[model samples]
Target: MADDAVTTGPEHTDEPVRVGLVGAGPWATMTQAPMLTGGPETRLVGVWARRAEAARELAEPYGVPAFTEYGALLDECEAVAFAVPPDVQARMATEAARAGKAVLLDKPIGLTLAEAAGLAEAIDSAGVVSQLMLSNRYRPRIREFLARAARFDTLGAQARQITRAFVAGPFAFGWRLEYGVLHDVAPHSLDLLDAAVGKIDRVHATGDTRRWVALTLEHTNGAVSQLALTGEVPEGGYTELAMFGPAGELRLDFRDLAGDEADSAAGWATVRREFAAAVRSGRPHALDVHRGLHLQRLIDQALAGLR
Candidate 1:
């Protein structure tokens, strides 16, 4: 196979793939930048940001020159990694896909599902390798849970995914609270459960500023899940899921295990690497585009329920 051929490819020539990144945000710095730096198949050559100063700091260590213009960055890279706000993700992704540049977009694809559907359709038409960053699936705890599930499935009647706690990042654009937990963090676990078990038939949710969200999801597999997301808890709490199945039970707490210092984005590094390896082997990504779109729709329904 190609990936087995010397286990190395031309680095950054026409043979090697090039990646240009947009938004020198913390997510990009912590997740994509580090992963790309360590990956052999891709090169990080450019970064675009509104502020050149901030871009230089994050981009330079990765050996990529910073640019102030997003369009110029898109024009050059074979693929683009977007780490901007949810509202801006669609616009950039759609434009880049249309420009024939493959894209790696952050989740909560857009403010709503219709927007997400549009972007999905656009990316499909472009015939490019578009990937969404969904790392919770790669969490060893979660992956083990899935491995053990096998045929019997995880939840018996109903289980719950709980996400609670608060974070205060001064660098954030302050748009964090506007989207609610379902859009912000719930997608990770929700997408996991959806893939591990099945689709969510319905979700009823309610919450406010003090609490990120308090919600429940009912799966078509006859599993019901209660999800609690809030910020009142100290140390910025994290995600935990308990699945009740016929065979037995499975539980994983992403926060308690890692404590406060977990990279939060480390799982994503593996997810991207797996995707790259699959592309080289001509196999489907572990997670597919439809799953991403379906999760977006579930978020859409949950948000509508809130209203």
Candidate 2:
């Protein structure tokens, strides 16, 4: 293990990991930056972004220096939390991992399978810790539910996410508008489904002009899932994931929960805390880059079917 070992290895120590923030977007400003600054096991030392002015603005309140050069920021910190777009994050995270810096990444690790594979290769080669920010995975309730749900013989599952994210929401990114809900929101649903049920083997999908997408996933464990996603919904749309087995059924209603600011904040805080623990302990998080790649593959399959 090198001095900057990112994954669980001989290089891990009990010292607090120095972390940096990458990307000065809304997500970075609202969640990643604050959580890194306040996390007990991690110190937020620097910030960087493609836009230097945005980086300076974000780093000012924390009294951290904003780096115009991304590599300079990587040099100042042992780990990086990326709040950039999927493509940008994939490129930067690959570089950071190659530099032996641990990475905390956002969902849909990459826009393409090649990018995701490249990131996985970089992380594996560098032996650096990499965690994806799948918000639901960090929720205590969701974790407990998945644990209990996994015990039974999962028969089937259903995940439905209908949101007006593009209509009028904080997640008004151009990518979200262009790609619709499958890329932006389906990753969460798919990740939760994979955790509760099993790995996805194959998928068949169909959708309409309204951006409504329905997918039937065949899980390797003999469990099947129906996932429906759409961004063209009224404000305060519906979101839920239900898994059924011989024992019983378990369902999570994320509609109201996601709309709750306090709950969302708490989820992000837990994500940051767990990420910090991973950096210090060198233990790979449950939602690691490999898992992100798996989800990305599923996303790619679903998108392909849609086309």
Candidate 3:
């Protein structure tokens, strides 16, 4: 399926795109649900989750109906924002796209390359617009940094992300504990590196344990990037992504940014705005399903190398 062939949906005559929230998890509560409810270009019309009680609880506060059936929610909404596990997200996102709904998805796309590719193909074949919510990509400062970095002679980059969330926090899911930081957090770092330099052509990765993984990526643009990821760090973890050249280096540290609440909310709001604009314009966003598939392939390669 061709990139430009994807359409958002039928014209809405200036009405805001009705968006449904899927998977009423911590992320949905903290970010996706709030963004859709408050966003100017989108309206939160309904919510669905595997747990009926959870879905009802999430929907009650917003006054939107809790859908017992996933398809029923899809039927009422022009777009779907997913906050589910990767495997569930892969399945439902494919279903949503096949049903002609625009998709706003969480990162990693799916647990495996095959799953990711299938979702991408489904979205493309159905001619539906899609965007993966890589939070850093939606940050204005990060975007500005990438734009400026593009002007410089390319060299190499380094990214380090250390978090304690997997050890104990609202984000500490069993899947994250099983997969570790490589699968849980590296997608954000990889996406940032790809945006700053170019597409990755190859990857070499290794780790002694699930908690720590490192990767060296060879970008198609001749730039290389090294990433170190861990989720067993001490409280108040560190994150830094830096790109270098003869002009010196540019870097961003999440610690230096605003609090998580404000920063995360703002980032998700940008995601909502971009998704809404894509739905309106029928133009694919830069962070589309194909990009998710590419990242998932890179991740799969890294995982293979780890074994």
Best by TM-score: 3
Query: Global CA lDDT of candidate 2, please?
Result: 0.81
TM, every model:
0.83, 0.90, 0.92
Per-residue lDDT tens digits for candidate 3, residues 1-307, read 0012123443333678899999988999988888887756799999999999999999999999999999899999999999988989999999999999999989889988999999999999999999988887777666667777667666888888888867877888767777777668989888777777777889999994367888999988888989998888868678898878888987877777757666666677777777888888888887899888988999988988988
In model 2, the Cα lDDT at residue 32 comes to 81
Candidate 1: global Cα-lDDT?
0.66
Against the true structure, candidate 3 has what lDDT? 0.83
Who is ahead in TM-score, 2 or 3? Answer: 3
Q: How good is model 1 by TM-score?
A: 0.83
Candidate 2 on 1-307: residue-level lDDT in tens?
Answer: 0011123333324666799999898999987887877656678898998899999999999999999988889889999999988999999999999999999999889888899999999999999998888876766666667767757677898888888876776787677787777778888888777777887888888995247889999988888899888888866678898888777877788754656776666676677667777877777876789989998898888878978
Q: Which window of ten consecutive residues has the lowest lDDT sum in model 1?
A: 1-10
lDDT of 2 at 84: 86
Could you say which candidate leads in lDDT? 3
Steric collisions counted per model: 4, 3, 0
- What is the full ranking by lDDT, best candidate first? 3, 2, 1
Q: Which pairs of residues have clashing backbones in candidate 1?
A: 156-244, 165-230, 165-231, 212-230
Candidate 2 TM-score versus the reference: 0.90
